[model samples]
Target: MMHTSVGWHVEMEFREDDQHTRAVAMVRLPDGSEVRAHGHASRHQTDVNQPRVGEEIAAARALNELAMQLLTKAHGEIDQASGRTSHPIHV
Candidate 1:
């Protein structure tokens, strides 16, 4: 029997404007495929001006979206391997 271990590196970037913060998350797989997702957070009139909070929220949302996309891709691959039509699989 044999075992193998694999790893991937994920990166994230954040940008901010006067009223909004944007985040992008990216992952590059060993097979040269890349997955990326974006998320944003907006400041309201009543909200306190907090840059760190905005960055945290935006980055978390972007990572969440990225995770969902990766799960969807995995589900599609599984369906193809099993000779079945791809179906929406909620995570």
Candidate 2:
């Protein structure tokens, strides 16, 4: 019998520009693999200039992209282990 434990860490950073907000999200895996995703939100001419709102939107988008990346990685691993190509997994 074999047993293993794994852990990962997630970090996010938001940057504000003159008319846009950018967010970067990173995931660090136990095997030293790092996955990164980015998102951006632009202020519209008629929309309110809310820093918090931009940050929230950008962060959410970045996290969503990160989730998809992680899922894809897992699916690829599963395919390799199974030794057969399977349909792409959707989140």
Candidate 3:
């Protein structure tokens, strides 16, 4: 498993399998904002109905990227609504 962060936060996992692999991403913003995303992909030698571990990772990365983009947009909206200075907060 690996942890990644952009405007939001993301997590990905890899497993050994000939079938499809699964991945998930999550994001939390200020003021208790939260969102989640997921992806799955098939691998070589695996049925199209199933995804490989690498494919799963790739899907997860894509989902995370989307989450980050959403967070970035939402963050801007939140800051604008609250009229708060742009600064990273520890939570």
Candidate 4:
């Protein structure tokens, strides 16, 4: 049996104000490539102020986008290696 171990670390940063929250999510691949995604959340005029909720929403969106990007990248690589179009990859 052959065994291999790999690990990836993701970094997330957020910026928030009274009405808006912005988040950036990044991951560094083993092949010396970096992928990043951004997300934003806006507070409604009548909504309660909850910084944590805003941050969570923004971060989740950013991470979701990042996952989609990674999947797309893998799909492209698979197609390139196989020399044919592959099935669609979804989040």
Candidate 5:
């Protein structure tokens, strides 16, 4: 992959307190503009036990939100460049 297309990077970090996890995504557009997405996940339990099902679900949701945000931002940038909108045509 070329450096140009590789505009986004994903980072996931787990905190030591309250099973908190954070995911940050950063992207650079073609116009040399940068955007960021942030998501935080947390579990209630204090133990390190393989992340319970609910915890996994929460983490997944957080990551999904972060991904969607980043993609939406990128799509917006592209749409602006191409002069497009989210509205559909009426027949």
Candidate 6:
């Protein structure tokens, strides 16, 4: 059995206000490239105050965007090396 492990570290930052939350997520690839994505959440005027919920929503959106970006990057790299366009499966 192979005992080797690989890891990646992602960083996220948030800027929040009473009615809004914005998040940015970033990760550095082993090839020395950095990818970043942003997300935002806004509370409705009638919504109750919930900072934690806002943070969670914003963070999840940011992470989702980051994942999409990474997939796009990898897909481009594959196309470049393979010399053919490959269709992507929708998630």
Could you give the C-alpha RMSD of every candidate to the true structure, in order shown? 1.7, 2.4, 9.3, 1.1, 6.1, 1.5
Candidate 2, which segments miss by more than 4 Å at Cα?
1-7
Q: Whose lDDT is higher: candidate 1's or candidate 3's?
A: 1
Q: Which runs of model 1 end up more than 4 angstroms from their true locations?
A: 86-89
Per-candidate TM equals 0.85, 0.84, 0.44, 0.93, 0.46, 0.92
Global CA lDDT computed for model 1: 0.91
Q: Using TM-score as the measure, what is the rank order of every candidate, best first?
A: 4, 6, 1, 2, 5, 3
Q: Give me the displacement of residue 31 in model 2, in angstroms.
A: 1.4
C-alpha lDDT of residue 3 in model 2? 92
Q: Please write out the lDDT profile of model 3 over residues 1-91, one tens digit for every residue.
A: 9997646445555443565565656556655755665666556563354444466566656676655667567678889999985654422
lDDT of each model, Cα atoms only?
0.91, 0.89, 0.60, 0.94, 0.56, 0.92
Model 3 poorest ten-residue lDDT run: 44-53
Ranking by lDDT: 4, 6, 1, 2, 3, 5
Best candidate (score: lDDT): 4
TM-score of 4: 0.93
Q: Write the per-residue lDDT of candidate 1 for residues 29-60, one digit (tens) a residue.
A: 88799999998999996988998889989999
lDDT of 5 by residue, 1-91 (tens): 6555444554443333456655554555567766555556666576554444434554565567666765677677778998986543222
Candidate closest to the true structure, highest TM-score: 4
Weakest 10 consecutive residues of candidate 2 by summed lDDT: 82-91
Report the poorest 10 consecutive residues by lDDT, candidate 1.
82-91
TM-score, candidate number 3? 0.44
Candidate 5: residue 7 lDDT (0-100): 44
* TM-score winner between candidates 2 and 3: 2
User: What clash pairs does model 3 have?
Assistant: 20-51, 41-51, 42-51, 42-52, 43-52
* Tens-digit lDDT string for candidate 2 (3-72): 9887677788999976899999999887779999998999997988899999999999999999988888
Residue 60, model 2, lDDT: 92
